[model samples]
Target: MKRSNIRIIGVPEQQEEEQGLENLFEEIISENFPEVGKKKVTQAQRVPKKMNPQRPTPRHIILTMANVQDKERILKAARERWKVTYKGSPIRLSNDFSTETHLTRKQWMEIYKVMQSKGLNPRILYPARLSLKIEGEIRRFTDKKRLREFISTKPAMQERLKGLV
Candidate 1:
């Protein structure tokens, strides 16, 4: 159900209400994803602020796309583009994930960063899987223990990721 949903961050509070979220979404599409042209949004609303109410950053906008394909396209465009902005101000787009899924993904971030610094191409797959390219083959790891076990065989890789694993 949440697959087609995305969260928009950094848009100021009440900005969507002035012109409407649907219009803002359309503008964002047109601005950052000209190829996408126009797409439909099934639902659009601002979620409650996650941090202190006094903070300057506004509440996140939850956008349910008309279909999962549209969501994927938008995300792909966001990735290819250096940055996604609305009216010159910067904004961020990300998949709307459940708390568990988000936390699970966070667990792999340290290792991911380490691998990235080592010049290894690392990608985090959907639902908390880590992918790394060693030599010419790509390895996918769902958990840290399994990743550690596999890295143990590779002395160089094991050495590179000693304490992290």
Candidate 2:
């Protein structure tokens, strides 16, 4: 008997085999799952939506007198008890009722004390003044007219205002 020698052939190149496997896998995925590819394509092509900026709105304010007093006492107290300062210099009260500036807190306190000592109510010594300034988001309601209206309309509010008075 004679012995025979045989040579074995190598499989196809690994790179080519790998590429073929990848192509087969992609074809299988596309055929079996079309929605996945569509979703990926749609997501890739989407653009974000634009948003609009907001504008701030203007607010309304109301004010009214908070107290009433006899004009004579206010004048007298302003003349005799209060001191007005302007530009670091003391202002003098003339007979014509002209002064460089308004009275100070200390002056107002002195006038109040004088009025209290004379057996007169402090509220009756000055005129009522109202001031409004927009601070922020908070709404501060200090309208005397609205307060009076509320007091007139609501018995509870009327009782509360009377207690304050």
Candidate 3:
């Protein structure tokens, strides 16, 4: 018995000829329809002009250093009231000596600075008056005679004692 092998050739050349024929057919169709050869068919479009709307500018209110001072005092009073009511202890002059108390002071100073920068007066609205109710409640638990004596002895606590009175 003899073994024989057959080799194949010219298949790739035939595939290339088929590809060329397809390209020629496409070119003929495009030539017949020129519109098909164009990048796009654009309609007569009208571009509208852009119009900017008018906006109203904001007006600022001016504040003085006296107003900031008043706000600082009010905030200090509020913080003192918070300390007395929540700390489960008697209201004393030394209560304002802690970092917790000083946080409120720092926040108040920040608010004051923001108000000053914005040229807005720190107005004591109805909300601030509502905060005073808590202050009054704390005052009921305090010893008025002792507070008065302490305030007289130390000028630092005078304003806070006055609020209690």
Best by lDDT: 1
Please give the lDDT score for candidate 3.
Answer: 0.30
Model 1 lDDT per residue over 1-165, tens place: 458998999988777768999898998889889998788999999986478867767889999998999999889899889699988999999999988898999998998999899888899999899998888999999999899899989999977877888
Q: Write the per-residue lDDT of candidate 3 for residues 1-165, one digit (tens) a residue.
A: 111111111122233244442342233224333333422111111113244457322111111212333324433443545532212322211111234434534544443454345443333222111011222342211223543454487565454334543
Candidate ranking under TM-score, highest first, comes to 1, 3, 2
Candidate 3 has which clashing residue pairs, if any? none
Q: What's the CA error at residue 161 for candidate 2, in Å?
A: 1.3
Off by over 4 Å in 3: 1-96, 123-165
TM-score of 1: 0.67
For model 1, which pairs clash?
A: none
Error of 3 at 11 (Å): 99
lDDT of 2 at 94: 25
Regions of model 2 farther than 4 Å from truth? 1-142, 163-165
lDDT of 2 by residue, 1-165 (tens): 111111111112232244542342233224433333411111101112234357222111111111222222222443554553322333332221113212322334543454356443433121222221212322222334543554477585355335332
